[model samples]
Target chain A: MLEAREPMSAEAAEVSRPSRRGTLYRGDPGMWSWVAHRITGVLTFFFLFAHVLDTALVRVSPQAYNEIIETYKTPLVNLMEVGLVGAVLYHALNGVRVMLVDFWAKGPRYQKQMLWGILVVWLLVMVPGAYFMLVRTVTEMFGGS
Target chain B: MTLALDKPRTPRRPAARRNNWELASWVFMRVSGVALLVLVLGHLLIMNILDGGVHRINWGFVAGRWSSPFWQFWDLAMLWLAEIHGGNGLRTIINDYARKDATRFWLKVLLYVSMVLILALGTFVIFTFDPNFDA
Candidate 1:
């Protein structure tokens, strides 16, 4: 029965060819950087969107705006604010790297070095920022309470 | 093994001409991304790190900031650039993942709707803000 089957036509084979969908983050630094970039970009954008809306609430009524902002003063929200800072920092640093890659002649060759540079700068900025944000908020929330 | 070979497929539609809009958008992403770094970081520093952090953000603070043309313009630029940059980024994601034409079209429709709504509301609030409104 197997030997009785006819060969498939060349045109049929071409028509049935599968499209290539690229691999999803298989450990390449460049690929992972872009993944991080996209995620951080999306997170930051959504936060800003909500932020604008809430800020605009000031125009609705001062009381409403103040009330909403007051709620943002909790320790939990303050902690989350630290995360927002981290996201913004990563996105900004990676963005500069991306700009260089697009325009700088030697950028692609030096991308790995740039990534390390970004990491060093990120830690330098973020350590102090996280410290200040966490310390001040915790102190304000609990130091007097 | 079967000896069938693949045949050449019909030519795809001709590639579209590169227009000024495409070039502008490419430029806009890098330029706006850089600008956002400064504006957004300054904003975070002022709003979340200086003078008691989020506690300092209040109706009065917002009112005072908006009263100044400098702050108003600063926020306006940040708002416009961030929204467009974000929307464009999402559009690229949608184009990449939404394989079906209808899916891509509807997703973009939703994106544009939200973008326009937010942009309009944000701009309106910035310029027409009347801090003296009766509560």
Candidate 2:
């Protein structure tokens, strides 16, 4: 019965086309890493833009700058600072990984290792920073109130 | 690695345009990314960690820093490089995801407008800042 089976025709091949969705989430680590990198990059950019604009307010007037800075010291903004820190950390680490991949001969072969290394370094740096950012800001903002 | 005689000879296509925009953008990403890493990390340390962190930041603090040409140039370079780097990354993303021509075109237009506006505003504020101006 197996020997008697005919090969698929061109029409059948066309009808049974693979969906693009399958390729999108096929559990490829590189694909997911790239996605995360892009997202973190964009988020970091927007945050930096806002930061520049707000900092620029100092030029307008001291009072205006002080008021805006005070608003940023609120608990809400401090909480978001955690997210910003995470994004920046990830983007910076992964950026180094990307650079190595482009420049180093063995980088492409060991990309997975590099990614894991980046994650370890990111965790090491971010954990302490996050603790400082959250604990210090929350205590300062709410302890007095 | 000579071509085999049995292989079919395909017609050679004419070379495309000589402009190196893609190559330039690729190189820019790597160089700018490395620079941004240093600038951004220093900024984070100063603004978010050292000397009482964000709470310490105020008009006087900024004025004091900007008083020096070094700080001005540091910030100006950061602003310019980051904006261009980010805008290029977003342009690549828009080209990838925006399937419709109109959608891609308009999205890019919006991106360019915002990028220019921010860059101009940031540069102007940095240079024209008058710490002595009374409110």
Candidate 3:
């Protein structure tokens, strides 16, 4: 690579190199959490559009509605349901954190702590939630009562 | 001892010229966010975690639920709130990322179009849904 770049002087290459320091503002927890919020928000919105379309099938015929909805019951879709719920849950929890940060007197001071708090709460809810959500899929995969 | 500054670096907009629409949108996001936290999480629990989960969802189940006025209202409220909330969120995203004026304008146009389409379609379906429709 160094021999291949013999055309350009070393100083020119050095000057052209992008600065690595503070490129992403150091990406603290607050920034990362916000990014997650935006990503989940967009995904959920698109899913919402699709969901509304799927639900609209109810008006066409019972068979049509039932047939489309069946796609949701498959194993892959069930796991995706878990992921969807997880995304929504994170957004909802983080949203509350955001509100607290905006409205509460000491919100900014405690924002980082609240981020961790929400994460804990997310785990608390999701563990059992995943189990319950995947019960049908699990039952079908391995014979169960 | 503090050194006094002659003027602020970035002057604030005059009260008259300042727009409240952005503020209103900000407030709406927080308020609607709280409501949706309850409405949507409860919806997930009931629809995805309770009893048979998504397996229980079917035409008959929908018909049975819509047969009640309470659920009808619940669903209608959810549909409207969620669509608007999501639309507003997308609006913010578009404003943030779309650099060019034309790009931003057209993106918002697309957003608004789909928002209207989904709202209209969802509302029509809910209102006109007939449980007794023979297959």
Candidate 4:
């Protein structure tokens, strides 16, 4: 029997349901971009919450907060920090593009150009960001106890 | 674009009145996703790794980084990316669920309003943040 092509109402009831049609990322820029934005944004939201809570730990007691901060000083911890900042950065930049779409700044012909524009902007910011972050790490290593 | 001229006829409303919002949204998600992978991953590697760790991050850290045009650009990139991603996702949901023209229109207006305000506020925060604020 041939499988039903259209998603059925019952299928909607199931959680974590993915259609047989290959993932939408196979499509064009907007589909995957939208998905990435969503996944990253959700992740960012939770991470932001955690960041706030982690910082707030200091309010309870300096010793408690310092313990968490000390652990975050490791290489592995630094690695995660990169991921965190990256998530925040990408999500933020892409968010602006999405907002522009509302106003009709990009059309079919301009779509590719807009994508490239976003890339250039990302690079412009990232290079300096990386430099400063590195400098901070280096300084901390040599300057502090 | 040619297909756009060929209208989907419905007794209720003319196709001309209906814009190609859905198709544009579909395209946006994909493009944004690819960018996210690259930009976000790169951001992570640089901030967390590359040198020391979190203890290295402090007030001077923010000042030292932001003072440069480069990190300012980086913060700008991250800020724009997340905002667009989130706003587009919300747009998709609005179009999918909202039915009545008035409802959809107003909701979208509200969405855009909040979106702009947040974008402005966040951008200001990134650029104006002072690492040297005296406690």
lDDT-based ranking: 3, 1, 2, 4
- Model 1: per-residue lDDT, tens digit, A1-145? 1110112324324543234336342444665777888888888878877888888898889999988998788888888998999899888998888777667877766776788899899999888887777776767667665
Question: Candidates' DockQ values?
Answer: 0.38, 0.38, 0.36, 0.08
Q: lDDT for each of the candidates?
A: 0.80, 0.79, 0.85, 0.58
lDDT of 3 at B106: 100
Q: What is candidate 1's CAPRI-style docking category based on DockQ?
A: acceptable
Which CAPRI tier for candidate 4?
Answer: incorrect
Q: Which window of 10 residues has the lowest lDDT sum in candidate 4 chain A? A: A1-10
**Model 3 residue pairs with clashes:** none
Per-candidate TM-score against the hidden true structure: 0.84, 0.84, 0.85, 0.45
Model 2 steric clash pairs: none
Model 4 misplaced stretches (Cα beyond 4 Å): A1-41, A45-145, B1-10, B17-35, B97-114, B130-135
Any runs in candidate 2 off by more than 4 Å, and if so which? A1-24, A141-145, B1-15
Of the pair 2 and 3, which is ahead by lDDT? 3
Best by lDDT: 3
**lDDT (Cα, tens digit) per residue for candidate 4, span A38-143:** 6666577446435534544433454555677766766566556556666566666665565454445333335445656876887886676555555555566787
Q: Could you give candidate 4's per-residue lDDT for residues B1-135 as a string of tens digits? A: 134343356455543546666566556655665576666566565545455435455445556777788877876775566567656666666666789989989988986776676566656656666545544
For residues B1-135, could you state the per-residue lDDT of candidate 2 as single tens digits?
354343344566455559878878888888998999999888887887666677788898888888899999999999999999989888888877899999999999999988998999999999999867766
**Once model 4 is optimally superposed onto the true structure by TM-score, how far is the C-alpha of residue B48 displaced, in angstroms?**
2.7
Residue-level lDDT tens digits of model 3 in B1-88: 3654546454873445365787788778878888898889989999998898898999999999999988888888889999999999
